[model samples]
Target: MTNPSSRSTVLSTSLTVFAPAKINLVLRILDRRPDGYHNLWSLMQIVQLEDELSISLSDKHSSITLQCDDSSLKTDPSNLVYRAAAAVLEHSGRVIGLDLVLAKRIPMGAGLGGGSSDAAATIIGLNQLLNLGWSREKMARVGQALGSDVPFFLFAPSAIVEGRGEKVAPVRIKGSRWVVLVNPGFPVETKWAYQQLSISRTGVRPLSDVHITLGKASALSWESVLQAAENDFEASVFKAHPTLHRVKQKLLAEGAEAALLSGSGATVFGVFRDETAARQAQSSFQTEPHLKVYAVSTTSDF
Candidate 1:
């Protein structure tokens, strides 16, 4: 299936971009950096769950306005989407007016990378809308300053992201699989997760070279990926939120090939090869009204 992350539609002066959510199949938190940021090695995959952004040129020069269907989201300069628009304008040195409407579906602070994806979408939409002629490399550089996960969206649907998320290497997967995401209807602040991890660990160790060697391969099979799948934050995060641990156990009980916590998350995802099984697992969560569940497929075209 064509990944929405790489697709956008244009009509007249308006453009619509789809910002697909991402899950970290494998996340290894490396040593804490002197800059107060943690080094990371993660295999990130883009899923079908997405947010939509509609962008149109305005008559007023150097002005930008944003609107969102989700009332909880801010539409001001503090919002990632709005900041992205301003970044694009500043980067291209163009005096253009913009109107942006964001339709959010991805859960916030669920470790789904919704906000970062939206920011990447804005950069991409404006690149085409204004004909900036910037390459993905240029766009990613602009994205990196916005958020650590922002650059990954520019290289979707799958990539090995490292080093505070500035490094991105697209990788080919042998096949696609269905994923069921279960969110406990709460947010896990990424910063808080990091602090917890720091306090929990006596000392930080650098990741072995073997993983880096495996990541450099031209392609990888699902079986191999699953074998290496792990998230370093799970131990610390789950300790704080016991419900998340139960969610993972439930997903495994539902016959998921593998169940894992995605990023520093309140969201846990199950990997399944069978679509029917994935859908069934999704339905099983209906009894729990407090949990949000979605059965989505991984993008085929990396």
Candidate 2:
């Protein structure tokens, strides 16, 4: 039998988790399956920027609290964090009510996987407290049920994700490229972006998932990579919101080695080879009243 002393220690413990951000270098949508999910392949990378979540046990009962710089989001059960906590607790058969606190730093709905990352972090923390001892694969299976991007956080390290985003493999795309993330103070829904896509001469609808095509892509020069940087959904997305297109152009105009839409974005990023160029581009955006800019770097992993 377990000692009461050990049990008390477990119940009073707390944990804080850091959930990072993600950027999709390429987003390609393949054929839609009868299951209602569009097949996708993406080259995803993590960034230094992140959201912090602080979780603890509720003395009174299961509880949750969330505070953020933005007051717009409801910090309650409707939030993904709530759903995630509920799932983990229920799965563990633990009656212990939790006090889950999420501090949102990553921008919401900018295609940065902010919410999904939070969900993933919650699962991990709960697994530790609840002694779930789940393998990365098992955790990913649970996370995939929450969001397509959640699985990445489970196995975290840059990955090449395919097949509705569940299949992941470690990829070696070299360089710690500097990044400038620009959020235009506008939110773009991934669903909305996909809905706007239509088959066009350039394959605007992206009938196939992304292909790395060139394997071990570490040697290519930045300029050449820019020319090859492909986002099949970009054509449709940019067409609807011309400002987004302009944002991509501006990143280049400011001297980014490569500029592309990050996921289905209202936020775009510029990749630079050096900090000097990255900082210069950030300063250049000081006059843009409509956009929020952040300096970031490519993570060694997704």
For candidate 1, write residues 72-169 as lDDT tens digits.
Answer: 99899999999999999998998888999999999999999999999999998889888998888899999999999999999888889999999988
lDDT of 2 by residue, 133-189 (tens): 877777778788888988877665466678888986655555578889988888888
Top lDDT prediction, candidate number:
1
Model 2 vs. true fold: TM? 0.86
Best by TM-score: 1
Model 1 backbone overlap count: 0
Q: Please provide TM-scores, in order, for all candidate models, with all chains considered together.
A: 0.96, 0.86
| lDDT for position 39 in model 1 | 89
RMSD vs true structure, all candidates: 1.7, 5.9
| Model 2 regions more than 4 Å off | 1-12, 63-69, 199-228
Clashes of each: 0, 5
